[model samples]
Every structure is written in C-alpha cells, then in structure tokens.
Target: MTTLPDGLHDFLAEAGWAGGTIEPLPGDASFRRYFRLRDGERRAMLMHAPPPHEDPVPFLDVAAWLTANGMRAPAIHHAEPEAGWVLLEDFGDDRMRDWLDARPGDERAAYEAAVDALVQLHRLPPGPFAPYDMDAYLREVRLFTEWYAPAMGLTVDEAGHEAAWREALEPLLARQEPGVTVLRDYHAENIMLLDGRSGGPQGLIDFQDALVGHPAYDLVSLLQDARRDVSAALEAAMLDRYAAATGAQDDFRADYARLGAQRNAKIVGIFTRLAKRDRKPRYLAMIPRVWEAMERDLAHPALAPVARWFDANIPGDVRRAQGGKIA
Candidate 1:
C-alpha cells in the first residue's frame, strides 16, 4: 500500500526552510490527507494524495476556473508533479454546515446565501475550463445502473427496471440548456464560510469533480442533503427562489421532483456500494433519509413508473439488512 506524501513541512524543512508554521489537520476521507501552514502571515493548505488514487491536475484546473469565475477557491501555490502533492490556498474548514447549524434558525439565511452563490455559479459562461457536456452527464447518470444497481444485490429485475430508469432519464437530459459552469457537488460540505467574501459567492473547495450537469442537480444536492435534512417548507422555498430568478416556473415542481428521484436513486446504489465494497459504513446511515426524499419526490405524476417500480419491487431492503424489520 502506498503511503501519503510527506507534505510541505518535510519538503521545505529538509532543504533548511525558514518560514511557514506547519500543522497536520484532521478528518480526511479514506483516499486523501491534508495539512495547514502559516507562512509569513499567508495561510496555505497542503494536500497529499498517494499513488493508485492521487491526481492533482483536475483540482488545479477546476480551482483556477472557479477562482476566475469570482469564487474564492484557494489558489495552488506550489506543487510536485510526480509526487501527487500540492500546496493550496488555505480556506479554513469553516463549512457552511457548521456555521449554520450553530445559529439554529439562521439555516434559512445561510441556505439563501448558498442559493445565491449557486445562481451566480450556474449562470456563468461555460469556458474551455468548465467543460460540462452531454456525454459526461450521460455517463455520470449511468453510474446508477452501472455500479449501484449491482451493489444493491438485485439480480436485474424483470420489466428491465434499469432500462426503464435509463429511459426515464432521457427526456430531462434533453431539456437541459446549459447556463453556467456547474460544480457537480455544490453542497454545504464543499463550501466554506469565507471571512470576508466580496465576490459573486462564498469560498469553494474539493471541486475537482466539477462538471456541466443539469443545474437542478446541484440544487437537489443542497436542499436534499444526505447528511442533514432541510425541512419541506424550506425545500419548496428554494425551488421557488431558483424558479423565480430563472423565470422557468413551468412545472418546476415536476422538474425538481424528477431530478430528486434521479439523484436519490443514484445515491442509494452509491451508498450501498460504498458500504459493501469500499467499507465506508458512514454513508449507509444517510441512505434512509435519501430514500425518504426519493419517496416524496416520486409522488409527482412524472415519476409514476419509477415510483411504481420502487413500490412494487424495492422499498429499501438495506434497512432490513441492517437488522431493522421492514414494515
């Protein structure tokens, strides 16, 4: 197994370095690690990604684009090409989640700020830097059936459920008129609560996976969060907010509900695969809430067949698998 890189501390120190206070930070996902440094009043972050997994090129490109688009993603100060190591701008881990959660009722205001940030992000021109095209979106949508379906231990159900799901995905996919460069995972976790942000949005991080997708996908990510539940009223309010701004109120409910079903179904398979194959059990607990969201979204007329498939064949067997009796 390849170990993580030694980071800037050892890299610079071994060369008789004289500046930067370095300290290793905590809470890295299973695949990566990070550290922070204070160098002559300038704060920076060091990310270490070991071999067989680590690649920094995408992060560099996406961060540059988001920064250029008026978002405060940290700048890449230095890097070691072959080592899979990089020194990046330090946007402290003051995530929107933590800041909003502490303030209680302030969740609405914080979420509004988040929505505004997203609006600005989604309305920007898609440059060569932000290449979110149909091929990529289709491939990503296929992951629901490609990886997640098998992970769920369903032996390819009759009526070709996967095929039906794929069929359902087409109309909505065709309706997308790409507005802005989409950051695929625009949620509270990836966004930082900047100290003094003056641009079009808040600080952004971990946006290497940015893609051009249906704008609704990110909106679904924010309102239909897997980690925490935002209430129904607020969720509706957000939908109205985005619709009014875009003037696309033509069945926004159906649109969001369809998108929500698509997202939640994809996540179900993903969370299961994570627990079973990747050994990431934490995601499994979040699956139930996502399932509930799917159930609600599928209530609309557009998702009748998709909802029927779930109702007849599967109503969350994972919960039963976890020793909780199915109702």
Candidate 2:
C-alpha cells in the first residue's frame, strides 16, 4: 500500500475517515497529488498540494462559485489551505477521455453534454480571477522560445520574437468579446462523466488556474485538445452549439481560430518544458498533434499575422523534426 503523507492520516481521522484505505490516484502535470480514501461505503478524494508549489484557496473558492452557480464542481468536504490539503467529493473514475474510449458510440453525446456544461457556466456572473490579457498571453507563449527552441537546437531572438508576436496578436486581442471565467484546462481528462446529475453530466476538476478570458478560450481547449483527437466534424458541431447557446455567433469562428492558435502555441512550449525541465518526456509525444492543431488554426484568415510569424520562425521542418520522422 502507498504510504500516506505525514499529517494526512491524522487529518482524515479527524474528519471521520479514520481506518479508511488510501490508494494513490493518477495525477496531472502539476504539483498536486490525489488519493482515494475509502471507509466502507464512503469515499472521498484527498488532494495533496505541497506548500510553496500550490495553494488550495483558489480551488476552494472556485468550487464554491461553480456550485453556487448550479454547475458541477467537486465539493470541498474539508480543507487545510496552509498545508495545501483538501478533501473533495469523489466524482468517480469516469473521466471523459477514458469513458469515451470505452464507448465510442457515445462520443457525440458526451461532447454535447460537455458543451452544455460550458453553456451553463458561461451564464454565471464572472468571478474574481486574473484576466487572461495580452501580457499574460505573451508571457505564456514565450515558453516556446525559452524552452522548445533551445531543445530543437535553434537560437531564438527573444526581442524579435516578442515584437512579432505582439504585432500579430494585438489586433486579435482587440477584436475579442468581453472576458468570462475560462477554465484553463477544460480538456477531456479533467472532465468527469457523471450521469444523473442535476447541474450537468460533466463534473469539473483541475480548475484552480481558471482565469477571466475570452469565452472562446475554453472552447479552444476543449475542441483542439493537445492529448486527444477530436474529430473535425464533432468540433464544428460543438462550436455551433456553443455559439448558438451563448449568442456569440458573431465573429465566433474567427475568435475560435485565433484562440486555438494561441492556445496550441502555448501548449507546445509547455509540453517541451515538461519534457526537458520537469523530466516528463511523455509530453513530447503529444507535440506533433499540437503542432497539427496549430497549423489548422493558422489556416483561418484571422490568424494571418500569427501564421506569418510562425512561418518565419518555427517553420514546419523544425516542428516536425521529432523522433527522426517529419510530421
């Protein structure tokens, strides 16, 4: 059995979960670790986020906001913010990705439900979160030059790259609609398929990094998933659904395309950093898909400036030069 972290045993015991069996759960690309605590028929998820690395307050606040707004976020049964531990409601093992894999026929329904959940979330008043503004956006994409470029044995002119990105992204940012609460990682893995739920079928997790951003941001994250394949047809259908539901059809496609490009660019850099710096090479395998998605997003006329910058800098050859195979 996996040894529980110090203080966790006593914490659970104090919370009436004494003598429960603890089993480690799969983690994401963050400092947080999850474990399943079971005591007879009762079960809860324990989140261990080491201090100085992560804080549980944002997650707790967001969960309460989501729940208050009639959305499905895990309930915080208990919390120890200073110690970075939280006991959350168990949403079960039905992560959307794994569930969809087992039932391919339900893909469309699952995606539609996910979109429905987003529609409900967008209806809620915006929360107090940092804006995903241009500065933040630029800072995130800089990870490309900072990490990926070096890994590819290429030299990056930081000033020149930033200038190009700024010129390319300025107009796009100006054209976006007002911001909303954007769950930064709204992909399939972080979404749970909970049936018979009042709020929605999707149970949200991993949303501590939520930000106020263009409504299209989470849509881009969902449709242009970095680690999974979402069919073009399904993506289009969901986009239509979201646009119609939220009355954001005006310039919606342009916004989607622009945000998709921005998001994929950021992911490439993040994945590269994860592989090289964090020593998690598994993320490297997802780069080609991200690059492919970025290329597709760049095909939109609205992304011309960004596309031109990418063509001049990263280019196809360097992007596809992985595993000795050209993508």
Candidate 3:
C-alpha cells in the first residue's frame, strides 16, 4: 500500500472520510497528485496540491464557475485551500484518451464530444480569469529560447523569437470582446468520459489555470495535443465543426494554426524545463511529438513570421528531439 502523505488521514477524517481507503492515481506534468478515496459506497477524489508550488483555490473557483455554467467540472465536496487538499466528486477511470485507446472505433465520436464541449464552453461569457494576452504569450514562448534551445546546445536569437511571435500573434490579440473561458489544458487525458451526462458528457479536470482567451486557443490545445497524436484529418474535421457551430469559419483556420504553433512551442520549452530543471526526463521523450505538431502548424500561412524565425534560428537536424540526460 502506498503511504499517505502527512496529515492526510486526519484531514480526510475532518471531512467525514476517516476510514476511506486511499489509492494514488497517475499524475500529470504539474505538481498536483490525485488519489481515490473510498469509504464503503462513498467515493471522492482527493487532490493534493501542496502549497508554494500548487494552489487549489483556482481549481475550486474554476470548478464552481464551470458547474454553475452547466459544464461538467467535478463537484467540490470539501476543500482546505491553505493546505491544498480538496475532496471532489469522482468521475471514474474512463479518461477520453484511455477510452479511445481501448475502443479505437470511437475516436470520431469521442473527439466530436470533446469539440462540442468546447463549443458549449465558448458560448459562455469570459470568466474571472486573466486574459491570455501578449505578455502571457511571449512569456510562454520564451520557455523555448530560455530552456529548450540552451539544453539542445543551440544559441537562439531571443529578440527575433519575440518579434516573430508578436507579429504572428497580432491577429489573435485584437479580439474586441472578452474571450471565452479557456481551460488551458483541454486535451484527452484531462477529460473524463462520464456516462449518461447529456449536452456535456466530458468531465473537466486540470483546469485551475483557466484563462479568458480566444475561442481558437482551447481547440488548438485539444487538437494539437502534446501528450497524444491527433491525426491531421480529425484535426481538420474538428476545426470545421467548431467553425460551423460558432459561425467563425472566416479566419478561424488561420487563428487555429497560429495558436497551434504558439502552444506547441511553449510545450517544447515546458517539456525541456521539466526534464532539465525538474529532473523529469520522461517529458523529454515527448518533445519530438510536440515538434511534429508545431511543424505542421508552421506550414500554415498565418504562422509565416514564426516559421521564418524557426527557419533562420533552428536547423532541421537540431529541431529533432534526442534522448539523453540534460547536463
């Protein structure tokens, strides 16, 4: 049996879950850890988001907002934000990614549902979160220059990187209205396939970093997933579906491609940081996949400036990810 974290038992006891058996669940790239708590027929998910590194308040706030808006964010049963423990309604083990892996034929349906969930979410007004603005965008892309490039033993032109991204992301930043709530990480793994829920069957998790951003952002995050491969055909079809549903067909493709490039670039940097700074080398193996998606996005005309920057800075051979310990 896995040993529980200190004060976990007393904490659970305080929440009326004293004797529940706790079992750790697989974690994500972040510092948060999840566990299943069972006391006879009662069940809940315990999120251990230790302080100074992780915060449960944002998760609590976002969950309340989503559920209030008719979305399927997990219901929060109890929380002690200071210590970073939250007891949530368990949505079960059927993550969209794992589900599709087991039932390959259900890919289209699963993706459609995921896309529709975004559609439903996009229709709502912006949330009480920070805008995914230029500063934020540049900050994220800088991860590539700061971490990934150096780790790869390549010195990149940081000024050129920022200028190219600023130009490329200009269109996205010009939206007149406050954008929809972007569940920053809305990919397959963060989505749970809850049975029998209508209109919004997908259960959202890992959404503490939700932002008010362009509608295209979450779609890009979903289609150009870093952890999984979403095929080109499916990506195109879903893009079309979102555009059709939202009446955003005009320039929507450009925006999607642009965000895809930006997001993938950020992931490449984040993965490198995870490996080098945090000593989690496993994320290094995922860099190639992120690079492939970023390359695809760069092919679009919308990403010309950023693509040119890549052409000038990172060469073909160096663009590829290699397996090794970062010194």
- TM-score for every candidate vs. truth? 0.84, 0.94, 0.96
Tens digits of per-residue lDDT for model 1 on 210-281? 766567778988899977879999988987888778776565567677778877766776776667677777
Q: Between candidates 1 and 3, name the one with more favorable lDDT.
A: 3
Return the top candidate by lDDT.
3
- Which ranges in model 3 have alpha carbons more than 4 Å from their true place? 196-200, 320-327
The sequence of per-residue lDDT tens digits that candidate 3 reaches over residues 232-300 is 899989988988898996677788888899998998889889888888889887887888888888999
Model 3 lDDT-worst window of ten: 318-327
Candidates by lDDT, descending order: 3, 2, 1
Off by over 4 Å in 2: 172-178, 196-200, 322-327
C-alpha local distance difference test of each model: 0.68, 0.82, 0.87
* Local lDDT at 5 for model 2: 76
Worst 10 contiguous positions by lDDT, candidate 1: 318-327
Candidates 2 and 3, the one with greater lDDT = 3
